[model samples]
Target: MGQPGDQFADLRTDYERHLRSERRLSDHTVRAYSGDVESLLAHLESSGISDLSEAGLPELRSWLARQQTAGSARASVQRRAAAVRVFWSWAYETGRVPRDVASGLKSPKKQRRLPATVDQGAAAAMLDGALARAEESGGPVGCRDVAILETLYATGIRVSELCGLDLTDLDADRQVLRVFGKGSKERSVPIGGPAYRAVRRWLDEGRGLLAGPRSGTAIFLGERGGRIDPRVVRRIVHRALGLTEGAPDLGPHGLRHAMATHLLEGGADLRSVQEMLGHSSLATTQIYTHVTTDRLKRAFEQAHPRA
Candidate 1:
């Protein structure tokens, strides 16, 4: 080609195309993977390895070791490693490389930190604050805010799933939401009366005010009347929590954790919770069980008099 770097650039473009067209990854994911692979290619060049076919696990490990030396978080290193492994997998499968050195690569073990969540009382207070603000403002925006908080706390869907919702996604009669989660996997999440009423009020009294000509059937719209952005949803959660006194600082995902933990404590089975939250594996849902168990242990330790 024109230069040694040109081949790397071309391969990077092709890899991005493969991630988007064949892997069915989201644009955000595709971009992240592309950036990681680009970094790997740069490392390869620095190592005087002009050809990717000549690259081996040693080169890959050195690239990751440099990230560690640079103080990259373990999670970041893990994700980068995964990106490289997939990249080489693709390279070998496509005949760009005779062998996949990345096949032998391993990511750092992920640290399983307990997800932070508000207590039930804090969640109630947060929702109450949202509703009070709606009442005081007497505006469509306030109504929308109330609906957003209520829906997130009640259904425990991801911010993206909440933003992706259309009016048709709501089963108003049955009080359930048709949520498309990660990988476009659809799951039906039941809504309690508080969440249902909040959504109904927004649909009736709020969304019309924000509807622009470009606004489609999306259930939630931004101030510009376009489908709501996930960032906006996060801001809504953050701002609501900020107003709620004594509540922990958390985003939309915190609400998901709170919902799961509260359900587990309320006697909901793991399988039911798993299905509601759209977790593909029961093990992923089991973390909440640990949360509940720890709480129970604390209570026992506090109340029991015997050693």
Candidate 2:
């Protein structure tokens, strides 16, 4: 091995490559992991420890403690700690470190914040608002907006997955969408008739008007007619939801949460939902259980006479 600093730099590169080529992590995940490792390396440098291999649990705990002292949110600190643990675990397995120094490091259990969701009535009104707006414009963009809102509620796909959709991804005959989710995992999610109608209208009547010379086979397009950006999807959702009186000012993810909660409440099984949402772990899908539980508690309190 060269100097500790050089070893750290070289190992970091290898780790990133491992994340990308071997682990097949998405760009966002890769960046997040790289950022956490960089922060740890910086911390190690400050303590005159150039080699990451020489660092151990005390240093890891100190770094976490410093993050807490600096007022990082518990959620953020937790993720950072997870990132570090994953990194050290990889290092040990690959022989960069003698052992997994971060194996015992534990992040505080994250507070399970219930996702915000509009009740059925509000959701219906929101969809109605989207349809009304579409009729008023009578144009492709309006059709696209209606489709965007409807598909988000109908399928519960991530904004990235929605924006990433191409012409071939929609199966109108079957009323299903081919969704490539995080880590590029693919799943087919069914689309309700209303959403399917809106998408069909957009494809048939609206997309042509917006298509430019640079336009490709993208299902959703920007003003310049290229593939839509996720930020634009967020803005569209916010604007569409804003049109509905008494509705929460939520973006696409809010719609996703609503879809998941509604599905669970309507008797959709956990395993099916896990497949539809493309969740890698059942635990991630279980958050919607809390949403349903809260709803049940409210319903019982409203109707039951035990009080």
Candidate 3:
């Protein structure tokens, strides 16, 4: 009965709950979608629209145009458009709107941006530095850092997945990790000997030094002995990469990209790599194949005898 802006508070709360409970989206994802909807509703209120039911394709287009004029990235605009479409679809189905105003809306095509990765030499140097620190310091933090870097490059898991790991998730006898990925999907990723040994060292000596009453079942612990935060993991990765000369500054995701590209270059099959990386789509895994191909082309151009 009130203005559309006034209705937003309760509706947004319900929508956020739906995303978290019904859709099983991660906290980060729920925040992004909710933020996009907030932007749209704010735009509608500024346009003097008192009721959401009155919004149409024109209003949607104008909002998108304003974002473009403001120089929003194409990918951000696309995601924002998708968020609006999903919100309106839900609204229509719930009998709040006569029809989905965003049903006809479309986003611009996503730009093709290749994932960034460190070269093999840089990755090796980083790992070596991590190991050197572990041995030189003989401290809990040093050993944990080595384990973290090894696990990240060896398994290609997300930072959240890494932080979420528990002691039971490590199948040490089998040399595999039980990884919980996006959307709560579970996958078992095999690890090499180095990663296994690094983890073992952390478990045997490092974790106990840092473990407090709050450590619980968490495999990785912060200085206070609580579950490690993803931000700390990112900082560790960035600092480790800094040890390698000429390596691009990258976070956990750069390790993921490097792992995938290195696997493809090593002749691993696409499906196997896909399963290891826990990607839902083959198309996503195929990007690493392109990365491998680009590297091969560069090598051929540099080394071939033909002028």
Candidate 4:
């Protein structure tokens, strides 16, 4: 068995590879885990913990306490703790440590922050403004922009998922879109009538105008006719929101949040919303229920006879 000090890098490398190959984590997630483990190793070095076998729960807790004292957010602390646990588990399995010291280590409980979701009227106005700007430009790019916003809002898909979509992913006749989500999980999400119309318009008019000989099977294309980048989608969403009055300046996720919030507000079931949003866990979907409750409370205060 290799000594703990000598195996830190090897363990980290293997852990990262495991995350990529076995867990199928996205690049962003792999980077986050890598950063967390690196931060822990740096802390261990400063703390003089030279051997993996020498580490224990007290050392792990102490590190977490220091993080708390340094004002780390609960979410970050939780993630760091999770990373440490994964690292120790890998180390133990690979004989770098006699046992997993990080076993049963509790992470700081995170208070979930409710995401900001725009109201239906504001959402409509924002989409309208985006479409108007696209029309005013009177170009293929503008039409494509309008289509992108419509698809995002309509399907409640992540920007990355939307950008990864191909032309065959859309079943226009069935009003469904095949979305590849986190961990490359695929789900069929529905698109509404308005979004369908917008997408059809883009395909017929805008795409043909922008597409060149090199254009591939991507449903959304850039001016040069290759696949559209996620960064461009973010920029388009940011600019579109800026043109709206009093609308919250959120990225594409805001539109997704808006869609879930509005759906729940309009009597959609929680499980159905969860599936539509492609959330693997119902817990993640429950946050929107709280948003719905807050809205209900406000409505009751304004209109109930008891008040």
The 0-to-1 C-alpha lDDT of every candidate, in the order given, reads: 0.91, 0.88, 0.91, 0.87
> How well is each residue in 225-260 modelled by candidate 3, as lDDT tens digits?
999999999999999998889899999999999999
Candidate 1, superposed: residue stretches over 4 Å from native = 1-4
Worst 10 residues of 2 by lDDT: 1-10
Compare candidates 1 and 4 on lDDT and give the better one: 1
Off by over 4 Å in 2: 1-7
Q: In candidate 3, where is summed lDDT lowest over 10 consecutive residues? A: 1-10
lDDT measured at residue 260 in model 1 versus the true structure, 0 to 100: 97
lDDT of 1 by residue, 1-307 (tens): 0123776878988898999888788888998888888888888888899899999999999999988898999999999999999999999999999998998998789887788999999999999988988899998888998999999988999988899999999998899999998778889999899999999999999999999987899999899999888998899999999998989999999999999999999999999999999999998999999899989999899999971
Q: How many residue pairs clash in each candidate?
A: 0, 0, 0, 0
Model 4 bad stretches (over 4 Å): 1-7, 212-215
TM-score of 2: 0.94
For candidate 3, the TM-score is: 0.96
| Candidate 3, position 279, lDDT | 93
Q: Is candidate 2 or candidate 3 better by lDDT?
A: 3
Per-candidate TM equals: 0.96, 0.94, 0.96, 0.92
After superposition, which runs of candidate 3 have C-alpha atoms over 4 Å from their true positions? 1-4
For candidate 3, what's the RMSD? 2.2
Would you list the clashing residue pairs of candidate 1? Answer: none
Candidate 2 lDDT over residue span 91-160, tens digit each: 8888877989799998888987888887778789988988888898787888898889999999999999
